[model samples]
Every structure is written in C-alpha cells, then in structure tokens.
Target: MNAFRTTRWSLIAAARDSPSRAQAALDQLCQAYRPPVLAFIRHSGYGNDAEDLTQAFFLRFIERGWYAEADPQRGSFRALMLTALRRFLSDQYERAGALKRGGRTVESGSLLEVIASDGQSPEDAFMRAWMGTVLEHAMQRLEEEWSSAGKLDQFRQLAPLLLERAEGDELRAIAVANGLRTNTLAVQTHRMRQRLRQLVRLELLQTVGSPEALERELAELRGALDEMT
Candidate 1:
C-alpha cells in the first residue's frame, strides 16, 4: 500500500544477511510468476520439457541472487521476470545439459513439437497464463470468503449473475432457485462484483511494487485480456 508498508518486501534487502527472509520473498515472487514463466517456456517450443526447466530456472533465479537486480523504477515485475527467464533458458541451453527436478535429472530437448505457433508469440502465452492466474486467484478468494461466512450456496447462486449480463427474468429464476427475492439477488450480485474487483486488485498489488503502479498494471492486464480474446 504505502512505501513504508511495503518495506517488508525488503526480502532482497535482507537477503545478504538473512537467508530465510530472502527465501520467503523469493518464494512469493516465484508463486506470482511461475505460471506465466512456465507457459512461456512451453510456447517457446519445449512442450512438457518446459516443466523441468521452469523449476530449474526458479531454483537458479533465487539461489543465484537475481532478485537483487529488481529495479522498480525501470519496469513491472513481468518484464523483469521474462528477461531473467530468457537469460536462464539461454544459459541452460549453452552450458548445462540437464536440469534436476526433485530427485530425477531431465535433459533439455529441442523445439520439435510447437504448441502455440498459431499466430501467438511467447508474450501472448505469458499474458494468457497470467490473466488466467489472476482470475483464478480472485475466484478462489471469493469462494473462501463465502465459504468462511457459511454462505457458499449464496455465492454459488450469485456467481453466474455476477459474471454475466443476465436478464430480469433470468435473475428472477436464479432468485427463485436460491429462495431469494429478485431485488435481493440483484443487490447481492452487485456486492459480489465489488468483492471480485477488490480481490483482483489485491492480487495485482502482489506483483506491482507500489500503489502508484497499480492502475498501469491493471491497464496492462486489460490489454493482455483484450489481446487474449
């Protein structure tokens, strides 16, 4: 939220001294970007071979102190991560022959069976995966919140209307199904939509380094969604 508030993400700042804290921050960063990174590797032509490389890249990324180079003044975390991932892949292909996943050592393969060459670049694959991850996080937060309140059934009934433009008749039908008045259901749908936006904003904030960058990040997300469709 605030600069002082976000100082805790100083996981990198404490990294040279505190290994545990640095690992925590690295884990947070990886959790946010892992989906898109892996998808980009896959679309780059590695197919399932991308999985092991993805894991190896992350291990090298944190273990090698790459987070120390994060320059918020330069760009979004997306750009930084992609740049690092590209470098990691290049290095892997250049020096290393195989990557270790768990106990098994898997060898990297060539781009033979292309998965996303249908008019989409690696950036497109990253955007698709990132957007899907964002939506999934929002839906999960919404469900957990509703479930914790013991109103999961209410969330279920209101989810469809919240996501789509439903007619009055359809709203009424959903209201009847949930034993709720049409007016009540409509109001709940509005609130649910508001909550969804809040969840999305919170999730987006985890990637953006500051509150000021949030709107721009959201615009990027919107652009990504538009391109994806």
Candidate 2:
C-alpha cells in the first residue's frame, strides 16, 4: 500500500506514533479535498467568503484535532469530512446571526441567499465536486506515468477515448493518424483504461478504511460519474 493510503484512521494513529507524519498526511488530504470543500461552502451560500471560510475551517479542523474522532467503522473519511464541514458552516451562520442580534454589523455579502437552481443539495454538489477532483487527479497521475515512459503523446491522444465512447471508424482514424493498426490501438486503449482504473482506486483508497470500504467507495464513484453523463 502507498504511504498516502495510510491515512484517515491510520492518520489518527500516526498522530500518536508520529505527529509530524500525521500532520503531513492531514495536509495532503486537505489539499486534495479543498475544491470539494469550497464547492460545498459556495453552494451553501458563502460564495463571498468561501476562500477565507475554507482556510479557517481547515485551520480549525486541524488545530482542534477534530479528525481524531473519525471512526472508520462508522463511515468513510469523505462522509466524516462532509459532516464536519456542515457543522462548521452551521456554526458560522449562527455566529453571524448572533452578531447581527447584538447590533454588530455583519457584512451583507457574507452570506448570499442560497439559490439551488439545479435542485441539488449542498451535499450532492460536494460529492460531484469530489468525484470530478478524483478523476482529475487520477488523469494527472496517468499523464505523469506515461510521460515518464516517453509516451505522453500516445496517452494524450487516447485519453479521451478512455472516458468516452468512440465508433469503430473514429478509432480507426485515430489509429491510422498515429500510424498504428486498429487492433493495436484497441489493445493500447484497453491497457490505458486498466491503468486509469488502478490509479483511481489508489486515489480512493486513501479515504477508505478497508478493502470493503474501498470497493464501496469505488462503486459510489462510478455511479456518481455515470449520473454526470
């Protein structure tokens, strides 16, 4: 298993065994999930202060050791994170309302009126963002791997086909353009897809506690991505 996958509950253990290593793991997770966190906050009507709020939320999360309460048996890390973020936003809203009641001026733009035009809850929006980010990171790692092997151009040309359907004629055209046989191109694309799946699983594994949880998360990821299409 990758050192990065030794996170979540393992991270809490690390805090006891090695605080520095645990902190590094926490930082990596925060960076990876920042986009989804921001999406949730913005969708919750904190668009104006999303950046500051995200930063502060992360600071509080880490400084207060809130993640120490994460129990793998209860749920995946993603669930734990979303729950914490929702609570944080609720507290922020309550604080602003209290200030207003106390005759303190709360910035008008601090909390915009939530307009969920798509009828998507903030939780749903956050999951979509998380799914997208996972794929983005997986693709990035795929590119780096192929690039290091001197096949960056091949990876680039075939990457789109990995995620989208292409007719036989189109596949042949792509193969011919690259001076390769259609069958060979098909094999290469299959390999690429397999590699991508492995990378995506690795990415998801960091947030899961066990193999069962990993499978569950991967299924959820696939379902979420399918919904997007």
Give the top-scoring candidate (lDDT): 2
State, as a TM-score between 0 and 1, how close model 2 is to the true structure.
0.85
Clashing pairs in 2: none
Kindly provide the TM-score of model 1 when superposed on the true structure, using C-alpha atoms: 0.79
Give per-residue CA lDDT, model 1, range 1-229, as digits (tens): 2453343234445664577776676676567668998888887778767888787877787788776767564566667677888888777655444334345555436433556667577778888888778778888899999999999987887787767889988889988988989888888888889999999888777666777787899998798778778
Worst 10 residues of 1 by lDDT: 1-10
Q: Write the per-residue lDDT of candidate 2 for residues 1-229, one digit (tens) a residue.
A: 3554355556655654576675675676678789999888888887678899987877777766777767675678788788889889888989998998999998866876664577666777899999888889899999999999998988888999999978999999999988999999998899989999899888787777777888888787778767765
**For model 1, what is the error of residue 145's alpha carbon versus the real structure, in angstroms, after optimal superposition?**
2.0
Off by over 4 Å in 1: 1-17, 21-32, 96-118, 167-170
Instruction: In model 2, state the lDDT of residue 43.
Output: 84
